[model samples]
Target: MQKQWLKWFVVGMLVFVGASICSRSVHADDSLQRVKEKGVLTVATSPDYPPFEFQVNQHGHAKDVGMDIELAKQIARDLGVRLQVKNMDFNALLVAIQTGKADLAIGGINPTPARQQNADFSQIYYYGGESFLVNRADAGKLNRQSALKGLKVGTQTGTMQERLAKQKLKGTHVVTMDKATDLILALKTHKVDAVGVETPVAKAYVENDPELKDFKAAYQLNPKDTGSAVALPKGATTLQTAVNHSIQTAKTDHLFPKYLKTAGKYMQVNTANTSMWHYWKYFLAGLKETLLISVCAVLGGIGLGVILALMRLSSLKWLSWPALSYVEVVRGTPMMVQVLLVYFGLGVFINIPALPAGIIAVTLNSAAYVSEIIRGGINSVAKGQGEATRSLGLTKADALRFVILPQAFKNIWPALGNEFISVIKESSIVSIIGVTDLVYELNVVRADTYRGVAPIVVVMVIYFVLTFTLTRLLNYWEKKMKHT
Candidate 1:
């Protein structure tokens, strides 16, 4: 039985390693086969841009709805699988494709040289022109291309508009944001003098809100319609062919014009779920996800942290060196970089969903800091404590487990509580890769309400209340531990 179990373990490891190698080393016709086998097609999208892609209510649930969403669904149907949409920032979309996290990505993504280098492109599914989105006050003043010089103009990062704005409006500082909504906020706050967005999206925004009532397109930036296409991973020839066929079929069936009309109908606050109660649901869902991830990450961190701390304290060079190396690497990098690496870089091998990948990344990151916290707590114990344990004839392991750990934990409990609070805040980074935490859900609310600042300010208050309450509770717990 022991031999049989060992044989099975070896086989599983081999299969995992083989799959990882195949995903990284080759880009064959295997994409469609893999999707069929999994029974789901993962599509990455930035849903803040409407008509092409944006959030809408369907079956009492918020879902990506637009021309691209339907096209992605059509492709999934063609392949005989369920469709799963992963919403994130526009820049992260190509990274998702490169890392095999998504079968394909769609937004208002253009066929640019830099993007073409990283991924494959499908046939153009939609087209729109570029124009300036300015504050109502500045609408008349910044009417021409020459008017933008020396002023700050905002666009979504890594987008064709940024490059175009740079070329056409020489001397203008082109500030970039991750999403269109963020750019809206930046423009609203007067961070930039003007923003260049696709003509339809800009018009939709100005028409939706009274604050933007005076806001209008200063002038058309580009005369020709810029084409939007579906993006696939590099060398995904077969999948690209499949996606192109889906687009052609939709166009032939006259489905795109109907999709546009359907999407346009979703552009108002008079719809269901626009009430305050519905917005609260978004906040509550986000809060639930944030707390859940933080608790799981902190628990895992404590377990692994204790082991790592022990290793670092060990006299053996082998154990201490590796633990030290891991701590340094994790602590040296920013939290967002770690999340990206774990979600995309490590995703090259195994198929990791966003939630588990987020937990694992958070766990690994938290353990590094937790290890140092624990080690400091342990060191604060007198040297005589270990000596006294040994004098009692207890084994070193038993002494550490029974005598040392209990006391060390008592000393470190307050720090552990603070770490929990820190994790709660840090978990916001997980939303970048589409984990749908508090920040991600709030973003959804902003999209639904078109009241960006209110949702952000409200969630900021929610986070502050949570951490403040947790801190007060920890202070009380620490005081009680001392009395005991």
Candidate 2:
């Protein structure tokens, strides 16, 4: 058994490593051609920064707006392709390019030396100033870089500001978050004393809210590292050249300033009505996707779980060992990591969209736990039930199918219901991959409104309503099954 397990593990590892190498070697230089062939230029961005990239509620739908989005449009037009924008966490933007999930990433991305090692970049499009956002009360004290000693400072993860905070601040505690909205939330709640942000972003936040203020803080920066550029996969010289051409044209036409002006108009519209009711469409769209993923994942998980449970119960080692290994491995890993691996890692071989990838990952993860519940329920059935079915001359397959599975399902229905409920809640993690689930829309609403806690409270209430309603239905069903 041990040797069989070791053999399977080694084989799995070899296949993964071999696939990774093939994927990299196969797609390294075809980035530009792929977009032309597909007739669509896919761009990935994190839309939480106002002037650079953000979302706005337009006719009950969230639309990507801001200078980065406008620049993406110009690049797509320059390439003679339609533009497809994907929203995700900022840190995942470059990964999307590297994995072939996107043709390029443009979310106010700074082309620092360290970042250049991972991905290629186009010519700089815009140079943004650096500023810090602090509470109106502390604006007097934290007005300059020197006053930040012993203070807690927040910065967006995988950003130039994060590097600046760590490298420049001598004694301040640096806290990193995945979203700019989250960092602002932290700063507003006093979780952090100050937040490092782009000068325009800081000014935008201060203008939208009375309690926030922006101040310049001196930090030595390389001139080359201060401007925003589009990121492409390493070795994608063709695509890099094309994007640089777009940037150059935009600069020559002075389009960036116009893009910023357009973005400002959308920002005004976003802030004009901060009520949750005005943005109900965003939440509704998110709820629809969340329920779709959860329903599909639950149904898929149950079907696969039944197969895996039966395999583990089989007498043949060949059938049982692999099933056992899969369950163990899946149950041991985190769901967030699994979602990323499925979306980005599997993306190398085939281009799977974010929504389907999220569903598949959740289904696979749920199957492991669901199979265990089924196995336990099967084991708890009386031995006499199997004997009686056999004595009645039913075949092994029919006996298990007609008699065993029914009873096992009845016994495990409550557990299955609990798993389903858990899926609805945990499915929020898919937002990290840009699935536009409730959490994703929550962040968008927060960014659009510039009111951190309100959107959070609204999303929390929505999740409660969903889960609470699900719990009630589950309890009712469990009771009905018992009575029957």
Candidate 3:
């Protein structure tokens, strides 16, 4: 009878494992096959950006227009695939392409050395230079770069302007905002002394707004400082070649310049004199902040999750109930809502000043999910193991600690790893709450430099690196757990 039970148990386990693996494999194969069979190329972009990929009401149907959008449509048409534009955040556009979620990212990306490592690029589409926006009153006082010393200079967190401000103007306190709109607000509110941004955007702000008319471009950024190009996912040579040829054709047909003219209208500035290299440093600086947010959120979430999980599983009803409640509430609501509540609502209601609301919200949200994972793990252990310990005269608590929880943890580790991967992606939502995470950084870079696509590509590569590393680590742990 004992041999029969053991044989059946082993067979059941193998079946469960095989089913899980097969399901994942099938999903992967289907996605790839669909792309080949359909022959429709999906291009990801951020439609919110003007002159790049902003949305237009064409007979009440939302259509995207801008330099990059038009360029991508041309490429898709030439390739004989129905062109599909997938609207997403500027930062997420590149990730979509890199992860095979989209065929390409043609969202006004600037080609940089760092981005080139993970993605191929088309020839330069347009070029623009970085510049600084300062109050009209301060403009005359700060003509040279040295004038920014000791002032609070604000830039979109991950942009060429931020990097250049940090490197070129030393001893200045740099406050990194997430978007051009926020940076402009900061400048108007006197939250910062100056804003370093791209020339076209700076000119647009000054010319478009009556209030901003008081702000002027104190200096035009040097030409060796900007660039712009389309991004293809790493290993997508076919797509890259197609995109390059399309760009050359667009330029020859005057389509590229015409699109730029339309895009330039939104910014209230001409891009004819914009240099490609001027924005490079800003993109690199923003890239660093994006990486920082992802890493910090993961570490914070894991630590807080373990604690919440333990509390939820505790014998004490008071601890368990509240922990369980927290988990339920956080898991039940949208992450975006939680971020806004934590950053804007809680701060307003409690009058308690806190760190960036984004970090706190992500940590709290992670803990709740982690608790359920722990609860499931604890429940999965065989009841006999605990009963056997009690028969040996060991206390219930001692048995749980010494015999049951360890094995239970091993069983749930892979699930925990999957959760970690989710947390990495979900961290992007923190940007909506004004965190200069990867997504926010990309927006800043795009708005400031007008290199819409490159910054998104850079952020995407960073996310891929992070998630891929986590996956490898999870696999290693799974192997070790199985061995033990």
Q: Pick the candidate with the highest lDDT.
A: 2
lDDT score for candidate 1 against the true structure: 0.80
Estimate the TM-score for candidate 2: 0.96
With candidate 2 superimposed using the best TM-score fit, by how many Å does residue 248's alpha carbon deviate from the native? Answer: 1.3
Backbone clash pairs for candidate 1 read none
* Model 3 bad stretches (over 4 Å): 1-39, 47-49, 55-63, 213-225, 264-484
Global CA lDDT of candidate 3, please?
A: 0.64
lDDT score of residue 269 within candidate 2: 94
TM-score winner between 1 and 2, please give it.
2
Candidate lDDT (C-alpha), each: 0.80, 0.90, 0.64
**Candidate of highest TM-score:** 2
Residue range 1-484, candidate 3, lDDT tens digits: 4345545654674576445433432332243235446888777776544556654332322346677777877887887778877655555555455445567777546566656776677778776566677767666686656677898988765456666677777798999865555566677778988887655555555654544433333444443324668777665555566678888888788886687677666344322222324444444544465566556666777677767877877889777666666676677779987765564344323422222566677778877777677778888999899889989999977887898878877988988888888877887787653354567545544453344445566778877887898899999989998998
How accurate locally is residue 133 in candidate 3, as Cα lDDT from 0 to 100?
75
Range of the 10 consecutive residues with the lowest summed lDDT in candidate 2: 21-30
RMSD to native, candidate 3: 17.1
Q: For model 1, how does the per-residue alpha-carbon lDDT over 428-457 read when each residue is reduced to its tens digit?
A: 989988887889877776776677688788
Per-residue lDDT tens digits for candidate 2, residues 1-484, read 7557956885786599457845685545777888899999999999999888999888888899999999999999999999999999998998898888888998989999989998999988888889999999998778888888999999999899999999989988999999999988899899999999998898788878889988897987787988899999888899899999998999999998899899989989988999999999898999999999999999999999999999999999889888888897788779998999889888878889999999999999999999999999999889999999999999999998999998898899889989998999999999999999999999999999988899888889988999899989988988888987
Point out the higher-scoring one by TM-score: 2 or 3: 2
Please identify which of the two predictions, 1 or 2, would achieve the higher lDDT against the true structure: 2
Which scores higher on lDDT, 2 or 3? 2
